[model samples]
Target: MYLEKIDAPQDLRGLTTEQLRALADEIREALLRKLSAHGGHIGPNLGMVEATIALHRVFDSPKDKIIYDVSHQSYVHKMLTGRREAFLDPADYDEVSGYTNPQESEHDHFTIGHTSTSVSLACGLAKARDLRGGSENVIAVIGDGSLSGGEAYEGLSNAGEAGTNLIVVVNDNEMSIAENHGGLYANLRELRESDGKAPCNFFRALGLDYLYVKEGNDIEALTAAFRQVKDTPRPVVVHIRTLKGKGYAPAERQKERFHWGMPFDLATGEPKAAGGGEDYCDLTGRFLLERMRTQPELVAITSGTPAVMGFTPERRREAGRQLVDVGIAEEHAVALASGIAKAGGRPVYGVYSTFIQRCYDQLSQDLCINGNPAVIAVFMGTAAGMNDATHLGFFDIPLLANIPNLVYLAPTCAEEYFAMLDWAIRQREHPVAVRVPGAAVVHRPGPFDTEYGELNRYRVERRGREVAILALGSFHALGEETADRLKTEAGIDATLVNPRYITGLDEELLEELLRDHRAVVTLEDGSLDGGFGEKIARRYGPTPMRVLNYGLRKEFADRYDLGELLRANRLTGEQIAEDVLRIVR
Candidate 1:
């Protein structure tokens, strides 16, 4: 009732402290109900309920700009900002995104999904306000391990010397995507223990004023702290120590599991559909563990998400020092792996395809230029991966493959993936990146080549004439479907080729295809622009051969249905076959 009555931040201003406490409870209940049925970031939002309520209660939101870093924790902020229906009503569950979006509401300034960007974004807002001679306060709510990012430091350093009105609320949940790592966490721990009284302050050192609120979960404490710095002239960092998953017992017990979860049982806190089947993540973890047994100097590195590599807490424990978590610092992870490989130690950096985009310079200058044999296992590098605009996985091919001296391998199945990984770790020639098949866990029964010293050799699966289907990575299944359609519907036996390497083209195979093939169709589960398909298209540009590149367009698609997205891009088997028939017949 309290939550329903309040539609905006201004409404919360009227509520008494006791009434505000009741609203917080109402918000939590709504969050749990929605999160239980329609799963999203549970722990982060749960932890931020009071802080969000306090923020709304203290600040005039749209007038005074507030930006949330990696806005996964912005659910409660949404609730008070006229978007509560999305959380309270099941019918509207799909209405809002998991992160903050400016399109959704005026209160949500930035459409931030990535971590550690809020401080820099807020600094920009502050600078603009000063330029226009506006008096609105600029607040950057950054924490939940965002401080570990290099950009966060850069923003804080800039904010320090800017001598402008800026408030950075450090929501210290003492966890990143996983447990916090790096030397900065040690300083944070000291600050928390000392209750902001510690002489050695990271914020103060960067020329920013510092304040600490030990009881971050307490609405009154948070409100008081926010009010104190409401109109502060100089930039300041208000470090608040809060529990990650405060309200729910299950989340409190298993913080990481509930940080972001699938639809789960509300009572038992168990997932509705238990994970039983084999996934690419688990397969990668098992294979690496087995290999690490024989190889003493072998190391596995993750920026923040170890689970992406299938390294659970148990698996990470078994690996011990061998498994290193750099803590939300992808740039450092790439450089660190390069250093390890340069020192004659085998380093495998397992990262999500989206996260790896943050380290392109490192991939090019530090790893590829140095030619260190660092094996990077790229997860979710397909059209079917995370559909968020900020976390698009399909773009990695263009980002990584174009870099010189980097062997970007597109594994067709599980067998090929492991083979590539093994070869990448063992070989000391070039920096190799393995794009782990993002679709179903496909098992192809055959011995994949372990030594890939000889690059750009495309394997022909089914030889035929007129049309050559150069299926790269996960799109191999679609290629097979198109070939089947060509044979059944059009009475044509199309050639099916598996292009294992994405970085370079097999000129011999392309030349051979030109002799008989009238049209070459390249099927890749990535962007069409500057991707694997473009290289093939360019190869046959001057010749009589017609090259049709099929993949997602160079645009950000958010929370898209895989089936719908495929159909829109003309990626279906029937569509491809029909196009091929037109070109060939």
Candidate 2:
């Protein structure tokens, strides 16, 4: 009843402290019920219920701006911002995104999905307000995990000297996507234990005013704290210690598992439909363990996202001395990998396709410029993996492939991926990146070529006449399907080629195709603009050969059906075959 009556923050302003507690309970119950059926960031949402309620109760939304780092924990904020039905009602569950979006509501100022960006974004909002001579409260709600990133430090350092009204609420959940890493966490621990009275404080060192609240989960305490700095001039860091998965016992016990879990049984905490079979994560973890044993100089690095490489807590323990979790600092991870490789140690930085974007500068400058023999394994680099606009892995091509001195390899299958990984580690010539296909792991029917040391070389799976399909990475299987469909439907034996190297075009192979092939079709699982296919199309722009590039359009697609997305982009085998037939005309 209390929750139903609440449509906005104004509704909460009238409620007593006891009624607010009841609302928090109702919100948690709704989260548990809905998340069990349609999985989400359970741990984060559950943990932030009290704090979000307190925030809404204290600040005026659309006037008082609150910026969340990553916005993974913004579900509770959504509930108080006229979007409660999206979480409360199962029918409207699909209406809201997991992250904060300005499109969703005026309450959300930024469409933030990545971590360690809140302080900087908040500073900008505050600066803009200052320039316009407006007097609105600007709050940055960042986590303890976000503090590890280089960007957070930059923002905090800048905010310290902003000399304007800025409030940074450091939500110390003591967890990243994984357990906390780096020396900064030690300082945070000291600060937390000392109740913000730590003589040597990270925030104080950055020249920002500091306050501490030991009871972050207590709504009364949070409200009082927020009110204390409501209209404070100059930036102040309010460090609050809070439990990650507060109310739920299952999530509380296994904080990392509950951090962002699958649809699970709330009672038993077991996934409803468990995924089986070989995945890149588990495969990479095993490979790293074996590789570390063989090569003592081998080092596996992750940027607070060990799950990307299948390095669970158990796997990390097995890795022991070989593993390096550089916290949520992707830039640091890239630079660290470069340093390790330069010093005769083989460093492999495994990160999710989405998170790797944070280190584009470091990737181009620190790693590629030095031409260090470092292996950067990019996971979830496919249209089918991440459907979010901010987290889409489809644009990795434009980000990584365009950079010089980097060999970006696209693996067609598990065997080829392993082979490429091995080669990248052993070779001391250039910095290499492996794009792990999001498609099903295929062993194929034959042995993978051991002579993969040849860079910019493509493997011709099945050679034919007229139309040639140059499928890149995850699209290799689709290319094979299209090739077969062409033979059956159009009575033409089309050529099927797997372009393993993404960074450069196989000029020799393309020239060879022109001899027999009248039209070449390039298939990739990313954007058509500034992508692998566009590069190929440009390569044939001056030639007599016609090149048709098939890929997703340059736009942010949100929560789309995988099959519909393929059809809409003309990426399906039947559609691709039909298009290729027309091009062959």
Candidate 3:
């Protein structure tokens, strides 16, 4: 009832610690309700309630900018910043995003989704504030996982050199999607054990003031710590030790499992699986584990998402696979894979598609130029509405295509992914990049019967003369459904083709389709600008070929329903069928 009356941060300032504690419980209840209705990042949001309240009480947001790393924890911040109704009402779910967005509220300073970018962005803001003669406190709140990133260290070092007034909060819950890796965890252990009086300090090593708060959730203690560094006038690292799922017993018990997840029972704290299905990432991990056996030279590498891919220590040990988890250092992962390849070892670096962007230079120079035969699997290549613009996989196609001697393949189904993985490991010519789309089925199609670079050949889900639909990756299923709908509803025949490869257009197949088809429709899940569809348009320009490109628009897409995102991009089966009917007639 107290939370219902409060709509802004100012409301919390007037409440006592008891009322604030009660309000925290109410916020948790609202979070659980929304998550139960529609799945979201519940664990991080649940853990940050008291800490967020304490920060907002101590510092004035909007005036004193608080940039959250990854910003998944900003749900609590959103509720306090005049957006409480958005959390309580299910109908107004789209009112605020899952991540921090400046457009949503002034309290959210940056539009962030990617990990380990807060420190760098905050340093820039702090420098700008100094230049403008403003003395507003700039705080960069980063997770323990983000601290492993080389960029964060670079930013911290730069901030120290500049002597800028910046507060860097390291929310250490001892997890990073998977368990934490690297030597820094040992330093964190020392800091925690010594009760903030450790001798060899990592923050001080980078020429910054170091302060550790072991009890992060304690509101009074956190308030005191924030006040102590409010006017420190230099870069400071406040290492706060908090449980990932502090209030909830379920999250506290299974640390990595509850790092970021879907809806769960509030009382029992048991997670209800969003969709009853097998994880494609787990499949890749299993297949790789099997492959590592017999192939003694075969090895695996992940930046920080080993557990997400099901490559836990138990799996790794049983499969006898050599896995090198290089923390959040993506650039190191790429170069390390290249080194492994040079030593006559088959190194397969599997990373989330969005996170691979951090190592573009390393991929081009270190691996591609040296011509090392490495296999890089990019999972969740182009899934709409799953991630914000900062985490979109739209640019992977163009970015990978430009590299010389690099073979790029996009798998539409799970079977093809496994086959591609098999082919990539045996490959000795050059580096191969496989883009795996999200929500792929496990249907085993007939043998591929073609080598790599077969070019934009249609999968031929169905045959028709009036209209031909060209689908890539996961969009092929949509194309097949659209063809079926066209025949049933509109009395139209549609031809569907799945192009496994996105880099080079299959000129031979395109000519064949163009000869008989009245219209050609290209469907992809990435951005339209410089995407696969645009390449097709450039190849066959103005030849009575009506090429309608269906993909993500050139803008920053925030979180929304998956179905809505597909429909908005004209990617749904029904929408494609209707578009084909309009174009054909």
Could you tally the backbone clashes for each prediction? 0, 0, 2
Where is the poorest 10-residue window by lDDT in model 1?
438-447
* Regions more than 4 Å wrong, model 3: 89-94, 274-276, 316-321, 384-389, 442-444, 450-468, 482-496, 511-519, 542-546, 572-585
| Per-residue lDDT of model 3, residues 1-585, tens digit only | 887877667777888888888988998888878876676776787778878888888888889999999898888899889888889999987678888988888888888887789999999999999999999999999984888888888889898898879999888887876778889888988889998798988889888998888888877788889988996788898888887877677777877666666667767766666565687777878888887777889888989888646686688667554888889899999999999999999999988777888899999999999999999988777764256667776667767876776777777777777777787788787788888766454475667633553434546667787788887776777777877898898787877787777767778877887788877888777777877888888767967788888887777665656777777777777787787778777
Candidate lDDT values, in order: 0.92, 0.89, 0.80
Give the C-alpha lDDT of model 1: 0.92
Best candidate, TM-score: 1
Worst 10 residues of 2 by lDDT: 438-447
What TM-score against the true fold does each predicted structure earn? Answer: 0.99, 0.98, 0.90
* Model 2 pairs whose backbones collide: none
Residue 327 alpha-carbon offset, candidate 1, angstroms: 0.8
* Candidate 1, position 542, lDDT: 94
Which parts of model 1 have CA positions greater than 4 angstroms off?
A: none
lDDT, residue 202, model 2: 89
Cα lDDT, model 3, residue 76: 86
